[model samples]
Target: MTTVAYQGEPASNSSTVARTLYPAGSELPFTSFEQALDAVTLGAADVAVIPVDNSAAGRVADVHHLLPESGLFIVAEYFLPIRFDLMAVSGASLDRLECVRSHVHALGQCRKVLREGGWRTLVSDDTAGAAREVAELGDPRHAALAPPAAAELFGLRVLRSAVEDDPDNTTRFVVLSRAAVPAPHTGEPTMTSLFFCVRNIPSALYKALGGFASSAVNLTKIESYQVGAGLNASRFYAEIEGHPEEPRVELALQELRFFSTEVRVLGVYPAHGHRRTERSG
Candidate 1:
């Protein structure tokens, strides 16, 4: 069976997504995303389920940084809706808060409520971990911003419910495997991740993207970062729909092959947004 590695403790959203993404696989938990990638590299896990981005939280640059060099392929994508809850001890009230703790994104999601009382702010590695920490700390003054499911798991009280800025907040995660698979559906249409460095100059980016536009390949996302390749060198990453060789997609890739200094397609996989309720793993 495939063993899926995810960062954070059991019951973390990442783990939840892992089980959803690879139901028949075993689930492995890691303390960090780096460690999860390491587990897959070391063959401790057959794959990794990692959070790449959130609609409200925006880009997760670290995931992008790690992806290109990980030597693993994103075999599938899963979009999980995020619901942040304010958790405190059984008898704690909003008026009793001395501080609030959570990952930066979670804290930011509830910034208004957290800032209202001038409570001290704290950061943790993950939202569930913070909720668990608050439970272990036992201070009524300390609360955690996490999911209500996590609060229940940790025996904490849901002091407030669904406080995220966006009701439609969604997190997109990738299922990493040793080898690429025929776009996930396990069986439909999905996105493929690609990483490349464009030759630096005017229209370099425009020209690189021209293929997608010309072929009607449905380019989904594009991001750029400095590769630190000396004076003013930068690279870009892109995600596109369908495989690189499907008629129009093939033609587009051929066009980009010459213009890009370095080009690599990360993987072809099923859309994560389509698997919101998966529970196989």
Candidate 2:
């Protein structure tokens, strides 16, 4: 069976997406995104499934840098709606709880719930790990904030379902493979993600982006991230709609060459649809 490497405990959203894509693959868990990429690069796993963004955490930079350098290519995509639940040992009550345990992200998402309930919260490294701790401890006063699936997996009972601060939370996942796969939706509206460095000059970015404007193409997203250590250089990652061969898209990239230090087209894939927010926890 092919092995899929994911960065998180078994019940994490990343692992959930991986299993959805490669139902028959052996799942490998890594403590970090870098390690998951290592598994794919060293042939320990056939592919790595990772989250790139969450409605809550914004962007996951780990996947951005690690993927570019690993020589692996993103071959597929998945969007998982996020949900968090307040879980405790079976038959436990919320009023009896002392402190709640959860990942930092989860803690933030469940802030109001904990604060209003007069429960102290402890940040743990993983959501399911925290739930497992609560299950093993079997303390009536102990509770964890995790996904409903995690509560079920760890045999904890859900004290209250869908406790996240935002009901619209969703995370986008990318599946990478050693072998490059052609852009998935040649005929469908697609999104292309790429990074480029612009020369430090007035109007440099404006000149580079003007081609898209002249062609009536929309630049959907743009963000700058730092590269290099102490004497830092910055690079920009952008997402645009359309194929590379489209005249406007071609000219935009060509224009970028005159102003950019480097340009890399990371992936071109079907655009993600509007996140199903009401489904979030």
Candidate 3:
């Protein structure tokens, strides 16, 4: 079976996506996103599933900063509906719980329940990891906010289901592999991810992005961050609806190159179905 690496414990959301994408693959959990990506880069795993953003919690990881240098290609994307449950040791009553533990984002998402229960919050590295910790501690005074599936995985009892404030919470993940797959030139809705650094010249960014507007290329996402110690040297990660080799996309990129010090295509893959759902709504 192929091995899939993901950050967080066995039942974390990334692992959930890995299972959905590669059901037959073995899962290897890592303490951090860097470690999981490294596993793919070092040939220890076939692919890595990483959470990039969440609708409720905003950006989950700084993938914009990591992907440009990871030497990995985005092979696919997955959207996982996030659901957090309050779980505790079997036979542990809700009244006995003093504090709840989960990843910071999970805790934030479940604030309503935590506030209603008057439970203190503790931050763990991951949601499922918090469940594991709660199980190992075997404390009636402690509970965890994680996926309901985690209750079975970690031998806990779910005290409350779907505790998140938003019923429509969802997370976007990307599958990374050592080498790029040939994204089809046609037949499926495609998305291309790229990183570009604007030239020092004034309005370089405005000039670089103007072509997309003129070409009617839809930019799905764009994010900017400073590179190392160079405060003025900012790099932008962008996702566009067209492939790099397509005529209009090519023309837009040519203009980008003229105004950018560097322009690198990170991936060109099929857009996830969830994107269509989001757009329709």
lDDT (Cα, tens digit) per residue for candidate 2, span 1-281: 98999877877777688778888889999877888888999999998988887778787646656766788876666788889889999779978899899888778767779888898888876787888889899997999988778887989888899988888787788887787765754566666777788887788888878877887777877877677665444678787887777777788778878888788887776655542233252
| Model 1 Cα RMSD, 1 decimal | 3.9
The best candidate by lDDT is: 3
Model 1: per-residue Cα lDDT at residue 267:
86
Q: Of the candidates numbered 1 and 2, which has the greater TM-score value?
A: 1
Counting clashing residue pairs in each candidate, in order, gives 6, 0, 0
Off-target runs (Cα >4 Å) in candidate 2 are: 229-233, 275-281
Task: Output the worst ten-in-a-row residue range by lDDT, candidate 3.
Answer: 226-235
Candidate 3 C-alpha lDDT tens digits along 161-190: 999999999999999999989598885789
Task: Give the lDDT ranking, best first.
Answer: 3, 1, 2
Each model's C-alpha lDDT? 0.80, 0.79, 0.92
List TM-scores for all candidates, in order. 0.90, 0.89, 0.97
| Model 1 TM-score, 2 decimals | 0.90
Instruction: Name the 10 consecutive residues with the lowest summed lDDT in model 1.
Output: 272-281
Predicted candidate 1 versus true structure: per-residue lDDT over 16-103, tens digit per residue: 8877767787888877889999899889998888888888878753766888888888777777888888888888999989999988
Order candidates by TM-score, high to low.
3, 1, 2
